[model samples]
Target: MKFDKDAWLLEAIRIKYIIPREDGTVWRRKWISADLKSMSREVHLIKQRTHKATQRVYFNLTFKGITKSVLVNRVIALAFLPNPLKLPQVNHIDGDKSHNYLKQPTPELVEKWGEYQLEWSTGRDNEKHAHANGLKTGRGSQNSNAKLTAPQVVEIRASAESPSAIAKQYGVARSTIVNILEGKTWIHV
Candidate 1:
């Protein structure tokens, strides 16, 4: 089926149909045949599957003998609105991928998602958002890869041994020792 002046269904790309946008729910459309004469324009809400690794809902679309897994969020966003920034990222407005295509996408929701979500961000904007949301935790003892605890960082700071010696004794990198001493990595100690 040809897209109705909306580019919602690109005949060249093998997109058969696009579901109507709704609030707080995901919708699906059926794939259409390439031959216009034999076209079966069956439109329905598709049931998507969540990827085990990414925890994001996706659907498989076959085009030109290649099956491509498309993310639900991106499909919904592209269907309902035009991306002004032309940035190749789709972010959930409420930080929930399960909330995909539940409501009509507004410019305000897109703007808010771009401003607040990190993975959808284009650059340092994500970092600023994380900091603002108190989600920037890769520092001091809060760092998941940290080998030493806060008390150990304090002890290391007050130690008389050289950085290299402290690093060897604590099984940490020499840079960790140097940064702790110079108040670069563990300033909280």
Candidate 2:
């Protein structure tokens, strides 16, 4: 549970059994053991011969006094190896804690849960939050809007020969008359 400053990971392996493969090679089944003497009780179970509960032989560590216990398999010891990273918890580097090896660190399994602290704290996805800041309100805006009422536009059209001429004669911008003539933006016809 706590691999503290004083604590160290001890490498002790125990062979469960061996199975002969089709290629005439024997595969050794081994596990890791504890470094601390306090875990001696569980360590004894590793070498002891016990009765079979099911089909497979279960060679497990019996942590009598110590609350924390680890695998007593050699290959598993090789899997995690001499030391591990300062992780929030014990993680299987290769998705399998049984495959703990020094060179093969569990980078994928160990995620930075606190990396996006803000996201978790706010309870909102980053994309959902509109991170926009618009420009400040207008400053010094005169009668910039060429908002001429329909009646006003009609009068201008009637007084002048052409839309452009009407715009010029009525002191309105030429584009405004052209817009009215072409029935663009704001004007229906």
Candidate 3:
């Protein structure tokens, strides 16, 4: 199966931030279809590498006159995978964002790497999968910006102080205190 260019174009049109052309098409549609004959061709030629911040495999591809970073997994999924449910997010099953290919050591590679899997997933399911795989770190005391320790979380749970007072004492928001009190966060502890 081929990438559904029309579906992508229509989705792009739904974004309010995109500036529309005089012909009623958005900027994304104009450039995405301008010179690109097939997505597969562009995807194959581009050098695949991992983004440092995102850990996702991507490559820069020039469309019309604009060069943009294209995600390898999304391209491969759109081109080859079936998404009957039209799920919005693409998940790397093994928690390795750089692992996007379905087959090991594609024709482009001489050395064999194990097959990487991908699936169409909803936003919530994608997050659950990431947490399950330890890919995400924004939960509990593992969060880099977390102010409270596990002991503090326990103390907060046991405190009878008003939420505002507890928040003030801990230098955090009242909502944080409330969430802790209600057991909305810091679940593992």
lDDT of each: 0.59, 0.34, 0.63
**Residue 23's C-alpha lDDT in candidate 2?**
20
List TM-score per model, in order. Answer: 0.51, 0.21, 0.51
Candidate No. with top lDDT: 3
Candidate 2 per-residue lDDT, tens place, 1-189, comes to 754411322222222232222221223334224433322222121332223442212233322223333322222323333334422232222232223233322344336321111111121222122221111122112124645654675665566477667766778788877866664633321
Model 3 Cα lDDT, one tens digit per residue, 51-149? 788787765544445446666677666555678998988887767676666544454332432344677899988877776567777787789879898
Q: Rank the candidates by TM-score, best first.
A: 1, 3, 2
Worst 10 residues of 1 by lDDT: 3-12
TM-score of 3: 0.51
lDDT for model 3, on a 0 to 1 scale? 0.63
Error of 1 at 65 (Å): 3.6
CA RMSD of all predictions: 8.5, 24.2, 11.0
Name every residue pair that clashes in candidate 3.
none
TM-score-superior candidate, 1 or 2: 1
Q: Which stretches of candidate 2 lie over 4 Å from their true place?
A: 1-144, 157-160
User: Number of backbone collisions per candidate, in order?
Assistant: 8, 13, 0
Candidate ranking under lDDT, highest first, comes to 3, 1, 2
